[model samples]
Target: MDRALGLACSLQFLGLAGAMIPLPCASHAHVWAGECCPVFWGDGSPCGAATGRGRCQGVAGPGAPAGSDFRARWPSYFFRRLCACRGNYGGADCGECRHGWQGGSCQLRHVVLRRELASMSPGQRLAFVRSLDLAKRTLSRRYAIYASVNATPGAPLAFRRATVYNVAAYLHYLGSKTVGTPRGPNYAHRGPSFLTWHRMLNVHLEQEIRNITGDPSFFVANWAWQGRAACDVCTQQLFGASRPDGRLYPGSVFSSWRSYCTNDGPFTGNMSVICPLGNEMPITRLNGWNWDIPRSVFRGFPSWQDYYACLNLSQYDTPPYDANSRFSFRCALEGFIDPLSPADWGIHMHNAVHVLCGGTLLFSHQAANDPLFTSLHANVDKIFEYWRRRNPRSRYPRGQVPIGHGANDYLAGFIPVYTNEELFQHSVHFGYDYEYT
Candidate 1:
C-alpha cells in the first residue's frame, strides 16, 4: 500500500515537473542535481553533503543543564529565520522555506529539520557502551521495554557481542579526548573524503584501544601509504581503476567511489575520470557535509526497518600503534534485532543519532561552550549504528561487515543497541523540541 502511494506520488510529481528533466534543473524552489553538493552557511550538518534534507527524528535535548539556553538559541534565533537562496542550490540561508512555511522557527513539520542527539556527559552515555562490555551479565535480565535489537541475538550471538565490544571501544575513544593523530591545518592534507575521515578516525580509535586494552590484536592491520601514495594506491589496488590525478579517491577503503566530499569544492587526487581539465587539485571535504548509502545497494532491496545495530571489532596483535601506518582496519558482521528492511538511508541515520548522541543532550555546561564536542561523538555512534543496520543481507565490498551475514542482510539484522530506558539512565539531561512560528 505504501509502495503504491509512493508510486502515485512519484508519477504525480513527474507529471507536474516534466517527466524527464536533465540534472541540475532548477525547479520552483530547489536545484535538482545528479551530482552531490555540499551545504555552506552555518547549517549544523556534519560535512553537509547532499545526502538528503536535515532530519528531525531521533533523540533530542540539551547536552549540559544550563547550556540549554545557549543550545536553544541557535535553533530559536537563526534556524527559525530561513536564509536566502543562492546559485545552483547554493544559498546564504540554504534553500528558502516555501510559502505558508514559517521561517522564524526551523520547525516545518513537512520539511526536514536537523535531527541530532547529545553526548555531553560521557559518564552518562558510557553506560550504553558499558552494557556491551558487560553483556554476559545482562544476557538473561529482561527490562520492562527492550529495544527491538535485544530480540534477535543472531547465531553465535557471541559474534554480535564481540561486534558490540568493538563498537564500544571506538565510542569510548571518541568520547574521550584521548591521544591520537590531530586534524592538520591543511584541510586538503586531511583529504576531506568521507572514507578519509573514517580512516583517520579509525586510526585514532586503534591507537586509543591499544593504549587502554594493551592488546594490538584488537586492531585490523591494513597497508599504510604516505605522500602521494595516500591518494590512489588503495583504490588502484582494491579496484582495477586508478584515481585521476588530483581527484582524491575518497571511497578508497570502501569499494564504492561515491564520496561525501564529491561535491564539496575542488579535491586533489586523480580527477581525469571526473574532471575534463584533469587538474591536479588538493582534496577538500568541508564541514557540514554528508554521504548517503550507495544507490545500488537499495535499488533491489527489502522492507522498512525501525531498529538499528552497532558493530564492534577488536584489533589484531601487532606492532602496537603505528604512527606512520596509513591504514589499519577490521571487519564485523552485524545482526539486526528486527525484521524491518530499511527503505531509505535516512531511517537508519535517524535511529543511529539516538544511540550515539541521545544521552548527552542535557548535561551541565559552564559557559558559551559548544555542545558539538559532545554531539560529534554521538554522531559517530549514530553512523556506526547506521553502518551495522545497513550491513545485513547486503555485501559492502569495500568496508567491513562481519563474516556471517550476507551484504543485503546487513540492514536487516541490526537492532537498536541502546534502549530508551538505558538512554534515560545514561542521559545527563534531555533536550526539548524546537518550536516554530
Candidate 2:
C-alpha cells in the first residue's frame, strides 16, 4: 500500500510539472473564448471583429525583482501576445462586457450578493441545488478540455467537450496540481495566494453559473465554518443526507448528480477524461459515525477562540510565505500555524471543515468534485475579508511570493487572466460581497 501510494504521489508531481509548461502560443492564448488564428500573430487585430471590443497586443512579462523567491520559469517569463480589452469590454476575445458592466457599449455597474447557505430559505436552497445540477448537465458553450499538454494543434483527438460544472471542477483539480518548482508540491495551496486563488476560483464559477442559469442574481453560497459543527446543513432539505446504509436519499437533487474528471490514472495517460454517469455516490465517512479523521471533542469544528485568534492576527502574510511558517495570515487562517497542540487532537479552521466534510473533500485533487466545495471556500474567503477589514492597512505581498502567486502573474486557464494584485479587493473589482444573514 505504501509503495503504491508513493508511486501515485510521484506521478502526480510529474503531471503537475507538465501541466505548467507554457504552450507554444503567447499568453493571450491562455484566455478562453474563440479560436486564435496564429497567422495574425502581432497585427493587433481585434479578437472578435464583430464585437470590436478589444485589440490584440503584446503580453508583458512580470520581471521579478531581485531577491524574489519566484524564478524565471513558466508564468514569470511567460511573455506572449494577448487581447487588450477596450473600456469595459472583457473576455479572452473581447467579445463580452466585464462582470459588473452590461450594455450595448458596456456601460453599467451591478452589485452581487452572496449569502450564507445555512441562512437561505428552503426555496432558495432548492433553487441553488437545481442551478448546480443544471450546470453539471449543461455543455460549456465557450471552452473545450485539452486532451493532453503534448497534443498538437491539428491532432484529431486533441480536445473534448465538457459540462460547465466539470470544467470548474477540472480547473480546481488542475490548479491544485500545478507546481511552481520542478521539485516542489502545488503552488496554489499553502501560500499567500491560497485565499486569492480561491477568491478568483469562486468568482469564475459564480460567473459560469450565472451564464448557465441566465440569472444575474445567482451567487455562490458561503458555508461559515465557525458557525456550526455537525453537518447540520447536509440534509435532504439542503445538500443531501446519507441513509443509514450509506447512500443519499432518493428525493435529494444531489442524489441524481454525477461527478466529473475523477479518474486517478497514471500521470502519463491521456488527460481527456469524463465523469461516470450514474446516481450520486454517497460521500464516505472516515469512521463509522464521524466524517472527520482523528475526531475531536468538538467534532471538527473549531472553538470561538480559534476564530478570535485568527481574526486578531495583524499581518496579512509574513516572510517565507509557505505553510510551515508561523507568522503568515495564510497559515493562521488555515490553522496551520496555530496555538493548539496534539493533546487537542483537533484540526484548524479551513482544514478542519474539509476534514469534517470527509470523502472527496478530504483530498485536494478531488475536493472540488463535491458540489459543496464552492460554499466551503466562500466562507474561507469571508474570513479573509473579515481579517482584511480588521487590518485595513494589510496589503498583499508585492514580491517574494511563489510563482503564479506574484502580484502581476496570471492565474492559469482564466480568460482576461486576473493577476494576484488585480484580485486584492474582492468587492471593489469582482462586484460581490458576503452577507452574514
Candidate 3:
C-alpha cells in the first residue's frame, strides 16, 4: 500500500512539475550524463575531485546475523554505491569540510562548544531565541522532504518545501516511526541506536542552523536535568511562557510562531502522503512550575544520586538491547529502567525531563515544534558524552545489533546517510564537545 501510494504521489508530482526534472542532489552539483545521482556523487566520483577528498565505492552486503531486522527498511542491497571521504573532508560529496574542521583544504579544527542555556546572558539568550524563531520561518536551502520515491525510469520524485524546524521534526519522525516494512517497530529507538541517532540529528540540525544564520560558531544549548524542578529556560526571555489563560504572552517571540505537521493520520499507513500541513497554531507552553507528574518525590526532577547510579553502570547495554533491559546504555541513558528495581519501571533522566516540560515537548512527534526540544536533546547528548568519557574502553555495539540499529546500516530519511558506527566517536571525529558548568 505504501509503495503504491508513493508511486502515485510521485507520478502526480511529476505530472505537475514535468517528468524530466532532475532529482534533488545534496552536493549542489548538477546531474551528470542523465544518471540517477546518489549522495556524494558529484562531477565524476561520489566525492568530487575538487580537493581529492573522497572516492566512489561499492556498499557491502549484510553479513552475519543473517536476516537481521535492521535490513528491513533501508535495504543496503539497493544502495550499493557511496562516496568514501578521505582525510578531514566530510559531507555527502566531500563538498564541505567535516565538523570542527574548516578552510579551503579542510585542515582546521576549532572548538565547538555547547553551553548550558540558563548560563547565557540576557542579550545572548534573546539572540538565541530570536534565531530559533527565524529558523522557524526560514526555508532550508539545500534539502527538501520527498513525499514519494519511484526508482523506475523517468518517474517523478514527489517532494515539498519544508522549514528548518519542519525538517528536524520530519527527521525525528522518520527515525522514531517504523518505515520500509509494514507493522515493523521503530528501529532508531528502544535499542542501541537511540543515542547515536539523536546525535546525528543534532549534528544535522546544527549544520542547517549555521547555514541559515551564517554563523559558524552557533551551537545548540543544553538543559541540565538533574535536581532542577523549574523550566528555567522556558520564559518570554527564551522559549516563551504562557499566561494563566493558556495563551502565549503578548511580547513573546514564540507567540507568533506556528507549528507544522500537526496531523498524525498519514503516519499510520503510507508515509509518502505525509507532508508538513503548515497549520499555524498558537505556541503551547506548559511550564514546569504549574504541572506535576506522579513521582515519589514532590519535585519532578530526579535526584543527583539517581543520575550518578545510572552513569556507573559498566556495560554499554545488556543482553536483548531493547527498551526492557536494565543496566544497558539504551535504557539507562533514556531514564526508563527503574533505578529502584534495576529492572522494573522508573523515570529519572531523559523521559522525566520531557514529561516535566509538558505540551509539545511531552509528545515525541510534536516535541521538535518547541525550540526547547533542541536544548533537551543536547543535554541528553551531553550525558551520553559523559558516560563515554567515564568508560573510555566501552564502545557501541558492533556485533549482534538489531536490524535498524546496526553499525553500518544507514540512518533512514537523512541525506548523505550516516551509519551508527560513523557516529560512535562523539567529539574526536565530529569536531564538537560539551562543556558543563
Candidate 4:
C-alpha cells in the first residue's frame, strides 16, 4: 500500500465524514450578482453588448499610489471601463449567469456541494483529474490576464490569453503581492481578509471549471487534513506524486503540466512582481514531512483539537488585525501564531499544511502551481464556514488594515467587484456548500 494512503485509512476529520451532499441554503435575503471585466480584454462581448445584461462603466476603488503594482485594487490601474452587470448576470461580459443562478435566462439555482478528496470514488476521481487537465489546457473564455512587453513594473499593460487554470494560479500570486507597502504585507494572507479572499478564489475556480466543462454540477473537493498525521493526498491516485528532483512521477498526467508565474520580476517590493507567460515552468511538489519521514511540526500534521479550538475564538479579528492579533480566529488559523502554544512561532493550521507541502508550495506566490493548494484552501474554506456558523452575529472588524484588505476593498485581482465582507455570506448564497463538517 502507498504509505500516504495507508497512514490515512485510520484518519477521520472531526465532525466530518467526507460525505458529498446538497447544502441547505441559509435564509439570507440576497445573493451575489455581476462579474468584473477589464475593457481591454474581457469576454470579447463588452458586457454582453446589445444583450441588456450590462454596460461598460468607469473603474471604482481606492486610489493607487505612484509606481505600485496594477493589481492593488484589482484592474483599476489597468483599465478605466469595467462591466456593471445586471441582476443574476455575471462574468467578464455579463453573458453568463450569476454564481448561484444558472441557465440562459439566469433562472436556475445551482448549488455546488464540494466533496472531500478521500471520499471520491474511482470514476469520480478520474473525471476530476481529466477535467482539471482540461482547465489547464484551455484558454480562459471569460477573462484575460494582464501581460506586458517586459517584466517592468509599469510596463505597458496588454491583455494576454492564459490557460483557465493560470487565472487561478495568478490570482493567488497577485494576492500575495504587496499593494503599496514597501515591506512584506500582502492582500490575502495574515489579515482579516484572508478567509474572505480565499473563499472567492475557490468560488472563482469552481465557476470557471463549470463554464469550461459545461457541467454546472461540477464542484471542487477538500483534503480533510485535521485528523491525518501526514500529507496523505500527495499520491499518484490523488493530487500527484513527485520524485527526489521535484518532478512528478512519469505515470501522472500532471507530470507534463507546466505552471505559470514561476519566477518573480525585478520590481521593487518585499518580493518582486511576477511576469506571466514567459515565466512558465514545470509543476512540482514534495511532501517534506510525512508518515515515514516524521520531519515537520506535530510529526508532519495538524490536530483536529487545535483546529476546533480556533473555531471557538469569538472575534473575527482584534486590534492590529494582521497576523499578530491574538484571540482572533483569523490569525490563529492562518498559522502566524500557535494558538495552543501561544509563545511558539509554530505554524498552526493553514500555513503548516502549506509548509509541509514543500518545494513549489514553500513560497506563497508559487504554491498554487501544485493543485493541492486548491484542495488545502478548500478545507480551509470549510473551516472558515464552520466558524461563521458558530458565531452567527459576529461581523467584520472595524479598523484600518493593509491595502487591498479593507472590508470593501476589491480582492486584488477579481475583475468583477468582489469585496472582503461581501464573501462573509454563507456559501449557499453563492450557490455552493461544503458537504463535510
Candidate 5:
C-alpha cells in the first residue's frame, strides 16, 4: 500500500496550512494524555513524552459562559490539560505525522489515494477487514466516550472505554445527538459544517487505523453506492451479509459487533432523557428489502442524475441554512430540498442512501454502529470534495448560524479543535485525496 506519492510539503495556500507549524515535529495535531503515555490516542499507539513525540500540558477554558451545554465547550467538559505534541506529529493522540507527511522523522509528504472498495485487490480487501476487526477489539489507550444523563451543564455524566472503531461510532453519535440537550440538529449536519465535520471524522478514523496497524498508507475505502440497487459491500469477504433475524452473518466479524446508543429515545420531543451508547442491539441492515420493514424508509440507491444535480448547485449556503436552506449546494448535498427541483421535499442523496440502507443505518444518532457507515461517509466526503472542486464555495456562511455550525465554532467531539473554516479547504490540506466514482 505504500506507493511513494512524492508530493512535498509546501504552503501554497497559507490560510489553510497556517496552523500546521514546522516545529521539530509539527503543530495543529494535539492530544489528551490523561494517565496513559507509552501508548497513544488508542491501544498500541505512540507519541509520548517518553517516546519524545508529546507531553501533557495545562490548558485554558473553551471560553463558554456558565450554564452552557457540556459539549458546547468540548474537551473543557473532559480535561483542563492537553497532550501537546512536537515536530510533524499530530492526531487526537499525537501518535502520527500530520496528514501529508509520513515516517519516523516526519518530513515526507504522502497524499494518500483513497479508493472505492471494489477497486481493492483480494489481499487488500482481507487486510482492510482484519484491520477493522483489530480496531473494533482494541480499546483506545486512555480515552472514554461519555454519556450525559441530562442536558444541564452540571448533570451526571457516565464514561466508558470503547474500542477504536466504537470510538468513531460514538463520536458520530455525539455529533448527531446532544445527550439531553435538544439544541438544533447537533454539530455535523444540516448546514455548511456538514461537509467539514464529516470530512474531519473520516480523516480522524483513517489516522487511527493507520496508527493501529503501523500502515502509514492505510485509508478508509469508500463504498460508492450510486447506480446499484444492492449493497455491493455486503459480503463475508467485505462487511458480511445479515440474516432476517437482524443479526449479522453468524461467523462474520461484524456479526460479533454491536451498535452504540441503542437505549436512548428521540429527545427532540422531550429533552429530559439522553441516548445510551448501547451494545445490546445488533446492526440490522436490510438493503432494498421492504418485506417486513415496519415503515417505509426510502428504498434503492440514488441515481447518477441525482448525484450530478447535487454537485452542480453553485451556492454554498443561503440564509436560514439549517435544513431549510433553498438552492444551496450544501443543503442539496445533505439531501434536504431536492437538487433537481428546489421546491421538492423528497430525500435525494445523503439522506436517501441512509434510509435506503435500512435498519441500523436508518437512525442518524446510531448509524455509525454499522461498519460501512464509514464507507458511506467516505463517499459523502468525496462528493463534498468533488462539489467544492467544481463549484468553489465559501468556507462557511458569514451571517450568524446554528450553535456548532458557525465558522469559528470548534467542531464538536474533537480535541485540539477544528473550526468549520479550518477544515473547509481541500482534502489535500489534510493529507489525502479521493479516487471516488
Candidate 6:
C-alpha cells in the first residue's frame, strides 16, 4: 500500500486494460562489441588531449574567446579527426603526441580484441546464441546488483537517469571548457547549459550512427523503469498518485530520508531514495511507509533482499515491509534495426553480455570491475533505441518525461528550444547493423 507500489499498479492497470499503449515488440537483436568503459570523464575535458597535433584548422589558438565559433567547432573537429585515426590517442588537440601509442597517425600498438563477436558466421551465431541464452538464465537467478551494494555503507548506488544526465552534462562542460579535473587547479569551467550540451552529445552520437549506416534511421533505444508499485494508500493520498502527475522523481518514502539523500544530492548512495513531484505532500498521513516506526510492528527494515523475497514469496514474512523494489528494464529500438546496418548489433550484444556478466559475476564481490560498469552503460545506451520504438507515441519535454505541476514549464524554461520531438529523433549512441544475420 506504499506510494510507489500504488502508482505502479495503476500504471499496470492502465497498460493491461489498453488505456495506455503496450510496447510494440520484444527485443530481437543484441549488441556484441565496442568500447564498454566508464564514460570517460576527460582529464583535460571538452578540448581534445593536451599535447596532440596542432589545433583544428583556422581555429582560435589556446584560450580562445568565449562564444566564438571556434569554440563551437572544437569538439566536432576533435571527434572527426580522432575517429578518423581510430582514437589511438587522446588530448587537448587531435595530435600524435599521446603516450601508450605511437606512429604519426596515433595508432595503437599492442591491444587485441578478445574474440571478435562482429564477424561470426551463421553456424557461429547459432552457437553463440545458445551460449548467451544459457548465460542469461544463470544470471537471472542471482541477486540484484543494487541489493548487494545497499547492504553496506560507502557503496555507490546506481545513478538515476536525471542524475546521470546531470553528471554527463557536467563532464561535457569540463571537456569543452578544457577544464582540468573538477577539483584540480587552473580549472576554468563555466558550467555550460545542461540541456544544450546533452542535446549536442545526442547529435554527435546520431551522426556517428548515420556515418556507419549511410542511413539516418539507425538510432538508439529507450530505457524506462516500469514505474513504482501501486496500492490503496498511495492513490487515495500522496502526490504523483496518478500518471499525469509525473513518473520519475527524486526523493524517498520519508521526508527526513529524502532530505538526507538530496542534501549532497550529487553523491547520495541510497537507491531507495528518489526525487519525484511530491515534495509538498504531507508525511503525517503516511501510516505504513514512514521510517523510524517501531521495529516490533514491522519486525525489521525492508532491505533490498526483503523486497526481493517478498516479490517471490506467497505471503508477507514480516511487518513494516515494502515491495516496490522490483524493477523491469525496457528499450527503444527502431531506426537502429533498419536493413543493411553494420556491425553495431555485435557491439550492442557484447555490451549486454558485459552487463549480465557483471551483475552475476560480481554478485559476491564487494566492488564491481571497471570494465563491467562500462559495458553495462554501453548496453543502456544501446537499449535507448529499442525503448523509443516500443513507445513511439510517448513524448517528452526537453529530453525528459513530464509528470506534474510546472513539469512542462520547468523543462521548457530550462531548455528553451528543446522539445520531445527533437530529442526523439536522435538520442542513440550508435547505429545498428541488421547485417549481423
Per-candidate clash tally:
78, 0, 5, 3, 9, 65
Question: Which tens-of-lDDT digit does each residue in 48-109 have in candidate 4?
Answer: 65667778787666776544454553544434556778889886567667789987779888
| Model 1 Cα lDDT, one tens digit per residue, 329-370 | 111111111113321122122122212221221111100011
Off by over 4 Å in 1: 1-199, 202-340, 343-437
lDDT-sorted candidate list, best first: 4, 5, 3, 2, 6, 1
Tell me how candidate 4 scores on lDDT.
0.67
**Could you arrange the candidates by TM-score from highest to lowest?**
4, 3, 5, 2, 6, 1
Model 2 misplacement above 4 A: 1-45, 48-52, 60-79, 149-157, 178-185, 244-247, 266-299, 339-346
Worst 10 residues of 5 by lDDT: 1-10
lDDT of 2 by residue, 9-83 (tens): 112111222221212232233322223422212234556544566666666445644331212233323224656
Residues 53-107 of candidate 6 have per-residue lDDT tens digits of 2332221112333331222223221112211112554322232223234455655
Residues 231-304 of candidate 3: C-alpha lDDT, one tens digit per residue: 77777787778776446788888888666555545442324334334444565766653545455522356668
TM-scores for every candidate against the unseen true structure: 0.17, 0.78, 0.81, 0.83, 0.79, 0.22
Report the candidate with higher lDDT, 3 versus 5.
5
Best by lDDT: 4
TM match of model 4 to true structure: 0.83
Residue 23, candidate 1: Cα error in Å is: 43
**lDDT of model 1 at residue 210?**
35
Off by over 4 Å in 6: 1-369, 397-423, 426-437
Q: Can you write out model 5's per-residue Cα lDDT over 1-437, one digit (the tens) per residue?
A: 00000012222111110111112222112222222223463334444666667776665445765443445655443445555778777754677677788876678888999888989998998888888889888976534555444343223444445678877886776677542334345577766788888898888778778878888889988888877777888888888887876567877788888775556544422223333443358778877545443322233467787788878778888878767788888887777777778655556677777766777887777788888888888888888888778866445686767767778777777765567888888899888999854
Q: Which ten residues in a row have the lowest lDDT in candidate 6?
A: 17-26
Distance from true location, Cα of 15 in model 4, Å? 50
Candidate 4 stretches greater than 4 Å from native: 1-52, 151-157, 179-183, 265-273, 289-299, 342-344
| Prediction 2 TM-score vs. true | 0.78
Alpha-carbon runs more than 4 Å astray in model 5: 1-65, 78-87, 92-95, 148-155, 178-183, 265-279, 289-299
Q: Whole-model lDDT for model 6 versus the true structure? A: 0.23
lDDT of each: 0.21, 0.60, 0.63, 0.67, 0.66, 0.23
TM-score of 3: 0.81
Better of 3 and 6 by lDDT: 3
